[model samples]
Target: MIDISASPTSTTLVVSGDLDLAERDQFPEVTARVTGLRRQLVVIDMCRVTFMDSTGAAFLISLADSSRNRGGAAVLRGADARDLFVLEVCGALELFRIDRDHRCDDVPDAVEEPSIV
Candidate 1:
């Protein structure tokens, strides 16, 4: 289960989901769409992401590669501790722009629309 959307001004892709084996297939389509955008910011919002597997990690790496190829930025926001650890353990954390903000004690039930952007 994944919810993916792109920012209109920048090439930011907001993603929220489990992103494990069950939702791996949707990532490529998302990357394809985000990589073709005209903007330079590919911000992947992971605030609502609860799980991640090796396949999901690979998809993120691919997205980073594509963003770099286009000379854009790939920003990963609000990754949970476990998922961040997964990326670090896989040595994929350095490949993208990541923020480890866990200040909120209460996480939303779902990923809402990009109201901040």
Candidate 2:
């Protein structure tokens, strides 16, 4: 599941379960909504993600790229080494800011109104 929340300056995506080919169908709509927000920051909470394949990495890269193009930034919270490795292998690690110290619980309520999709 993916839950999106937004504040005036940032948007957060709380991702759970596996982010692989099976979840591909949801990526487009989620991407559109997130990019359309035009927020200055995008936070992807990956603490609950069990597995992520290349497709998931591509989705993350797309989000980071879009945010960068708009002069914003994308942050990945609670991402493990495996996730980072996937991004690195894809040559897209530089696209995001990895916050290894941050966890899902540390996310502020400023992103309180989540819309599940």
For all predicted structures, in order, the TM-scores are 0.75, 0.87
Hey, what RMSD does candidate 1 come out at? 5.9
Candidate RMSDs in Å, in order, are: 5.9, 7.6
Off by over 4 Å in 2: 104-117
Which pairs in model 1 have colliding backbones? 11-41, 12-43
lDDT, candidate 1, 33-75, per-residue tens: 7666656666676766777888888888888878777777677
Best by TM-score: 2
Worst 10 residues of 1 by lDDT: 108-117
Candidate 2 per-residue lDDT over residues 25-70, each given as its tens digit: 9999999999988998999998778789999999999999999999
TM match of model 1 to true structure = 0.75
Each candidate structure's count of clashing pairs: 2, 0
